[model samples]
Target: MAEICCQEAKSPPATVATASASAAAAAAAVASSVMDRRRRRLEMKRFRLATDLEESAAEYARAGKRQRLQRTASGSPPCPGAAAPAEAETVDPDRCPRYGVSSVCGRRREMEDAVSVRPDFLTGSSSSRSHFFGVFDGHGCSHVATTCQDLMHEAVAEEHEKAAAAAGSGDEEIPWKEVMERSFARLDERAASWATSRSSEEPACRCEQKMPSRCDHVGSTAVVAVVSPTHLVVGNAGDSRAVLSRAGAPVALSVDHKPDRPDELERIQAAGGRVIYWDGARVLGVLAMSRAIGDGYLKPFVTAEPEVTVTERSDADECLILASDGLWDVVTNEMACDVVRACFRSNGPPEPASGEGTSSSGKAVSRAESDKACSDAAMLLAKLALARRSADNVSVVVVDLRRGL
Candidate 1:
């Protein structure tokens, strides 16, 4: 019994267990550090790639080789030869930072059209910033379209500032809806003056000879959109349109203000423009519905007041499409939405965690992929419009709220 007790007195040392625990913790720390480093490197690489792509796009645009106007159909009237108004040519790309792709092949006439704006706002609250995107389709002349492109956003911003100041609102905050409305009004007014000034400066200009001899008579259709974090506000004057895709379906947001609708025909006739039916057709062969801006000479025949619509997007709203008549002439709102959705599904952006907030999470999921998808989609639309033999200049602006980055 004494010998058995002495043998059992010997026990294993405790050092081996302590050493094993310490080694496991050290390995874990090393693995975590390695993962963190990898994540940081990936993020940096993504940022650099996006920046380089954006810069390259800008340089391509500035080089002037990328802007080739689309041609008109074989028998279409030649595009008006007037130069884009002075202010129009000076559009500052820095103020608007958008990413897009455009192509124009003027079949019978020079394409005098413009599409898209930079997502960056020139001036606004840093916390509640907004993005501007638009498509201006010029028919009789490019001056009106170009002028609107150069100055429309600025006009909106100015009116917004004045309204906010008058109402004593806080810094950089303005009612975007009101601002958009007033800006459209202001744009018509400013365009009228600009056209008049150009006409006066060059009495012999060909654009004057083509229409009712007033600057307003030589007009282009406008479809503009201002996108905010919580809302999307669209304004349309003329036949241009703004459409949206919600949950893989198309929903038209802007009414096409044409000369044929009963109300529009009555208004056009009342304003002094002939809303006559050519042969058996109504509204002088014009298929558009409602009223529009510009067409100054037609002002008495057509009203400058635009139909405004403000929509609060649901969680399902996926994309917005703004286009000139060229696109609408060929593709319906539903078709446009379908194309965008297909592109999104096929070449969609990446999903990467950015921060802890829900908004950031959404942004990370939507905009993390390559911007080439957006550009490719827009180009595809324009190409399709052309293929459908859309006679007018084609311009399209596609805004992917989910993947705009």
Candidate 2:
């Protein structure tokens, strides 16, 4: 530095000026490089922030969709302005009374239970509508249950339509047993078709992926109830059940198809199948239920023929319940009825209208309260089952049948 200064002093003023200018230019270049680096870092940070926000939004949307699906699957009423589930038929709320549904995985590894509710599914010539509610418990897969949820009601509706056409009028006293039998037969055929067809898109479950050839072993228990103004028709192909609360008394609408039952055992033996006691009198040491929708390998033994029951409705009827074995295993029919009754009582009644006739607004208020009570009852039952240590999926559907407040 001293040598340069001495040389500059002896050389010329122009030399000193030139050196200073070069030094200033170098400092400017360094400063510009630093600014460029800072600018690049800021842009990268902004990009990351935008990506994170988009991801968060997408996750939120997915969560909301899942919640909606769960609500629909559990038979809970949809929120105002929300779209109805694709599997359920559109319902006219005025014609359809309030109903509630609750379903949970409980302690199961995978959820295999499904519920379907289609209010006003079948309309008669006189504008009378029959509501449909069903419960399906799948074994070895969830596809079967989901399939039943999607197709069972439609199949039943088609059969009803056919019967109505043949009888020349939907208002005529149609044979419900024949109609239900035909519908179940058709549903079984469709289930078989669905299992065999590999051309269709894959399911979201691990059953098919784990064992492609195990489709024949998959099956589901179906308990369906068609509720009209005058009657209640219940059909059962397996252990799921339907019960009615009439004037606060419990009524078993459908019997469970257990393998150990005398009639079921006789039928299985007649079909050349044995009910071995592996995990509770399973047919051929495999399926616990004597009858089911699928199980092609055990078709002759595990029939799809549902036992149908028709009951005349009465003004004293309070509510109707349909549930999978998970609820029935731990809770008795009477207890279930009691729970629902208590819920109804807890909610009390809507205020009476001033006039003798019920105003439209008064009816709406009553319906809303009834719906809430039903929801509470169904949820409580499911929770009760869980608290009792149920090891399977729990599903419950509560249909409010009260005529007036």
Candidate 3:
């Protein structure tokens, strides 16, 4: 260090010595301050590291506690509820038809998608633990979708109840596919009635969804799957679809109803409506879908009658997927099945089984990990669709068929 301060001195040596000592002292002080600041910054970083570790541990503990405590009545699963979860939904592997659902708002400004799962959709003497899973994609408004999410199951249950009552004498059998179609028809009529009943001048919903009575045809597309002990019945309207993952392959269960389809176009024309080419094919250049719920303005042209398909469950079936068009617009059935199968595999190498005598090539998925697999698969599909630039909201449901999830 070179000294800058020098006091009046008789000799040059003494003056030089004083200046050297003063400069050294100043340099030492500056160095000490710099060292102190660096030390404090390092300490702060360590403190933050500790804080973050503590928070993470606490969250993990809380999650474990919630899993242990959260339960529903016997034979039923719990809802994700108000926590909004922000995480994948899980169910105890002990439950039947191990299924989980997930929905995401993609490039759209708002999330207009709805999903639901009813473990014990119907309960009684027949004792069929039929499960219900559905995805509703809203267009122009989310109200109708939300409404269907809340009421569609009840309509189905009503029909099932009637069938069960009639079969009490053991003379009749409950036909699920027919019930599904009837339920869809009832759902459409219910929505139409509910919409027309609303005040003509009522205010729009929080999402700015128009009242069904006054809108340009606000409606929702629906795809539903009913998991009975013997059958997997699917019903769909609009473009939402359902696919069954079988032996690691994709088997489409419901066909997407598009305006461009021959039958759909013919129906529209028969109803005295035009199928015009606008932003692709559309009915009267208005609704892009040929069938939907609560499109009162386009009624007689756009119907809510869903096409139902029934497939008997077999050991070969792996899982089921019900998703909105937002997913189908970019993702394919094979791709979705592959993603879900991968998720199940990543969960823990599938449920371990002993002995090589069995010919089941694919490992069985455990009920405990099944929920995570389904939820993850759904979320992954939605994210994949978004990454592929899907322009609408996305929703997905995965039901583990083997070992009853």
lDDT of each: 0.63, 0.80, 0.74
lDDT of 1 by residue, 1-405 (tens): 988876665433456677888999999999999999999998887667556544543443343222221211234443376322121122121222223556474343787787658565547444455677877776566777777888888887677667766767542345665777777777778778877776645454457667434665556677788776666778787788888888777888887776666677777677566665664333435424344456665555555566667787566877788887777887888777766655555543323223111121122223323355567667777766765667777777777655322
**What TM-score quantifies how close candidate 3 is to the native fold?**
0.70
* Poorly placed runs, candidate 3 (over 4 Å): 1-94, 167-172, 204-216, 349-367
Sorted on lDDT, best first, the list reads 2, 3, 1
In candidate 2, which residue ranges exceed 4 Å CA deviation? 1-94, 123-126, 170-172, 199-204, 350-364
Candidate number that wins on lDDT, 1 or 3: 3
How close is every model to the real structure, measured as TM-score?
0.65, 0.72, 0.70
Give the number of colliding residue pairs in candidate 2: 0
Task: Please report, as a residue range, the 10-residue window in candidate 3 with the lowest summed lDDT.
Answer: 354-363
Better of 2 and 3 by lDDT: 2
The residue-by-residue lDDT of candidate 3 on 256-353, one tens digit each, is 88899999999999989999998999988988899998787898999888888778778778789899999899989998887776666555322323
What is the Cα-based lDDT of residue 313 in candidate 2?
78
Q: Residue 14 deviation, candidate 2, in Å?
A: 99
- Taking the tens digit of each residue's C-alpha lDDT, what string does model 2 give over 1-405? 999999878788888899999999999999999999999998887667556543543453465455445434644555676433232122232366668999999999999999999988875453578889999999988878888999899988888887888877543367788888888888788778867784255654576776665466788999999888778889999999999999879999999999999999999999899999996889999999998998888989999999999998787888999999999999999988987877766555322322122221222234566577789889888877876667889999999876643
